[model samples]
Target chain A: EDKVVQSPLSLVVHEGDTVTLNCSYEVTNFRSLLWYKQEKKAPTFLFMLTSSGIEKKSGRLSSILDKKELSSILNITATQTGDSAIYLCAVDPSSNTGNQFYFGTGTSLTVIP
Target chain B: EPEVTQTPSHQVTQMGQEVILRCVPISNHLYFYWYRQILGQKVEFLVSFYNNEISEKSEIFDDQFSVERPDGSNFTLKIRSTKLEDSAMYFCASSALPQGYRQPQHFGDGTRLSIL
Candidate 1:
């Protein structure tokens, strides 16, 4: 089975603190790794990482994939209260049948202002 | 920006009753998907559709569940007989390509299905 594991299921930090969320996965044929921020009822798209070493970033949110280690890390710098939400990690594997994506339980982040 | 859309933000149905969850994917996207997230559980893939046929489905998508694109703009998931455990948030997603190689899928807000 394809499995994606996220660490520190829940975290609390001050507004200015920097946070790092970890994701590790085991798949048959890895294709891409994606990050999502879910607030309220819907999950919004964040970043999608396909290659190792190269980091994908959007403002204060940045993510990098390490294929050699079968892991990825999402870093939030200078966090704010608005950044508080459940961060989801998903793994996309090469499937001839179709595109199959597997998700981790997710890391709940609470940034106190 | 174009996005996938779902109807009936919340639906409450009794066990053994049938339910249909609807979604309208992005007009230009070629592939569509259905996923569910149970309370306090990980979001799981249910099925993927392309070329008017089911391209892939997970174990959770059993005989009781079916999907159809009866019209050009709508994708629906039908549950023949809902069970108490069938309650969850169903999300619809779409991507520009069938394989979704490098294309990121856009997801709808999702429908909350509650089976009593």
Candidate 2:
């Protein structure tokens, strides 16, 4: 079974502080890693990383995948109160069947002003 | 931006009752999926539908669960019998293609189902 694990299950940081969330996975055929932000309900797409060492960024949020290490990291710099949410990481494996995405438990982040 | 939409923001059903959750995926997207997240738990995939058929389904999707694309716009998931354990937020997602090769899946706000 494909599995994805995330670290620092929960974290609290002051505004403007930088935070890093980690995700590592074990799968048969690795393909891509994705990040998502969830506030109250559904998760919104963040970034998708396919190649190692290449970082994907959006505003204050950035993520990178390390294929050799079988892990990924999401960094939020200059965090604001609006950044408080559950950050999710998911891995998609290369498979003929479409049910290959595995998600981590997620990291709940709280950014206080 | 176009997105996946689900109906009935919240639904409360009694145990052993049948329930149907509906979704409208983004137009031009070729793949559709159903997933659920129990409160405080990780999201779990249930099934994926494409080309008017089921491409794959998880063990969570048993005989009691069925999916259908009755029309061009709407995809539905029907649960034959609900259990208390079934209470969770059900999300509908769609992708132009699998994440590895193409766009990532976009999710709907989700339907919160509560089984009493």
Candidate 3:
């Protein structure tokens, strides 16, 4: 079975702290890895990483995928309370699998003001 | 921006009752999906629909689960008989293009289903 695991199921940090969330996966025919931020409502798109070494960034948030290690990391710099949410990672298969996505349990980050 | 929309932000039903979750995907989106996340659990994929037909479904999609695009604009997931375990937040998603196009699926706010 395809599997994705995240570390430190829950974390609490104060404002201005830089946090790193890790996600590791084991799957056949890797295609792409995606990050999502889920708050009280739904999971919103973050970054989708398909290449190794190249980092994708959006403002204070950045992510990179390591295909060699079969893992990815999401980094948030100078975090704010609004950054608090459950971060999810998903892996997609390369073969035509009808776009069936596999998701991780997610890391809950609490950014305290 | 175009967004996927779901009806009845919250639905409460008794076990053995039938329930239908409705969604309206982005007008130009051709691919649709249904997913659910139980409290404190990972969101799971239930089914994916394209061209008015189901392209794929997960093991969680059993006999009691069915999906349909009743109209050009509406997609629905019907649960024949609700179970306590079925209580979760059902999310509807859609992508404007086909898979492998590098377009991420956009999700709705989700419908919280509570089975008593």
Candidate 4:
């Protein structure tokens, strides 16, 4: 069965702390991996990683994919109260059936001031 | 800076009643998708539509659920008979057509469906 799993179901960190969230998956055909931040309502797009080794970065957040290991990690530096939200990891698999996205349960991060 | 939009932020319905959740995907997007997240649960994909047809659907999208692109701008998901288990936050998402790579999906605020 194809599934995506995220580690550290929940995390607590102080402001200015650095944290790393992990995502691992097992699928038939891997296309890409994406990260999202869900605050109160909708989930906003964060990062999308498709290749291995190379890192994708934006401001204080960065992510990388390891295709050989079938895993990915999201790193957040200079964490703030605003960064406290459920971080979701999703994997898109190329299939003859259709285009679908499989999501992890998400890592709930609480940054305390 | 276009985003997907959903109607009726919240809806309350009795079990066995029919309900239609509507969404207007980004104007230039070609791929549309529907997902649901039950309270305290992870988000789950329900279906994917492209070219006015369902290209993929999960097991949860069974006979009770159906999706339609009634017009150029509107995509709707209809529940034939709502059940208590159907209560969830339904999210509509869309993405531009992939050109050699996958495009990231953008989601709406979501419609909160409550079944009594």
**Considering every candidate listed, which one attains the maximal DockQ?**
2
lDDT per residue (tens digit) for residues A21-75 in model 3: 9999999788899999999987899998898999999999999999999999999
B15-91, model 4: which lDDT tens digit per residue?
A: 99999999999999998999999999999999989998998899999999999999999999999999999999999
Candidate 3, superposed: residue stretches over 4 Å from native: none
What is residue A109's positional error in candidate 4, in angstroms? 0.4
After superposition, which runs of candidate 4 have C-alpha atoms over 4 Å from their true positions? none
Which lDDT tens digits does candidate 1 get at residues B31-67? 9999999999999999999999999999999999999
Return the TM-score for candidate 2, rounded to 2 decimals: 0.98
| Residue pairs with clashing backbones, model 4 | none
Model 3, B3-107: lDDT tens digits are: 889999999999999999999999999999999999989999999998888989999999999999998999999999999999999999998775577888889
RMSD of each: 1.0, 0.9, 0.9, 1.1
Candidate 3's TM-score reads 0.98
The complex in candidate 1 yields a DockQ of 0.70
Docking class of 4: medium
Q: Residue pairs in steric clash, candidate 3?
A: none
* Model 1 lDDT at residue B98: 46
DockQ score, prediction 4: 0.70
